[model samples]
Target: MAVVNEGALKKMLKQYKYKDLTVREITNVISQYKDLKPVMDAYVFNDGSSRDLMSLTGTVPVSYRGGLENCL
Candidate 1:
């Protein structure tokens, strides 16, 4: 899993609270941080799959701690 800097992201979001931001805009900000770029690039989004949904079951399962790190 990618270790993102939550503090930095929260600060950025707070700054844009009054503005309407698109997903691409937010994604651009995320990609600006070197640490998260690799993880972001590793996945595909908006495909015709339940993985893009907001619910936990709809997204990719977190199996890193269950001896499936390599599979992810």
Candidate 2:
């Protein structure tokens, strides 16, 4: 599982404070945010499963278009 530091986690919460963001945007934040990059890297390089990552990241699972989707 990816471990998000306190600062990065706070920044992430602030980013989502105003409005809802698309999944793509969330992915972009994970990749682009400097602090979050380490968490993303850990997920990518450590053979971390998507489910595990999502759970750690506080993602909400939803049913959309007859498929499972993630929301935050």
Candidate 3:
């Protein structure tokens, strides 16, 4: 799982709040920081169907204590 620096992320978001940021632009910001870089992984369903969470939808799940709590 990728660890994010909340303060840094919030500051960056505030800096770009006035602009219409694209996914790529946001991704670039995240990628620029090591802790904020997203980890690519696949999500598999009970039926054996799987989808790459990163590529399928530029969002990644946030896990805490071995449990998923949210998506980012």
Candidate 4:
């Protein structure tokens, strides 16, 4: 895992934009945010394609048409 400073992590969370983050990248950020566990565990994907940037900050995504809307 690449070592990222707290500032970088915080900035990512603050201005969340959809990006292709690897599983390790997601885990690194989640390790810093305790409340993000549910979001982390509830979703799974290859290529981290289903990850929602907002969910990293504990923001739950609203379902659209009875399905979770993935950022990708």
Report the number of the highest-TM-score candidate: 3
Please give the ranking of all candidate structures by TM-score, highest first, separated by commas. Answer: 3, 4, 1, 2
RMSD of each: 10.9, 12.4, 12.0, 12.5
Worst 10 residues of 3 by lDDT: 14-23
Model 4: residues with Cα > 4 Å off, grouped in runs: 1-21, 37-72
lDDT of 4 by residue, 1-72 (tens): 324355544455543543335444676665654345423223557767564443444543447999965332
Q: How high is the lDDT of residue 41 in model 3?
A: 64
- lDDT on C-alpha atoms for all candidate structures: 0.36, 0.43, 0.48, 0.48
lDDT of 2 by residue, 1-72 (tens): 333354554454443443234334445555544233322322354566532132134455578999977665
> In candidate 4, which residue pairs get closer than 3 Å at backbone N, Cα or C atoms, i.e. clash?
none
Q: Candidate 4 vs. truth: CA RMSD?
A: 12.5
| lDDT against true structure, model 1 | 0.36
Error of 4 at 67 (Å): 37
lDDT against true structure, model 2: 0.43
| Model 4: ten consecutive residues of lowest lDDT | 33-42
User: Measured by TM-score, how close is model 2 to the native structure?
Assistant: 0.22
**TM-score, every prediction:** 0.23, 0.22, 0.28, 0.26
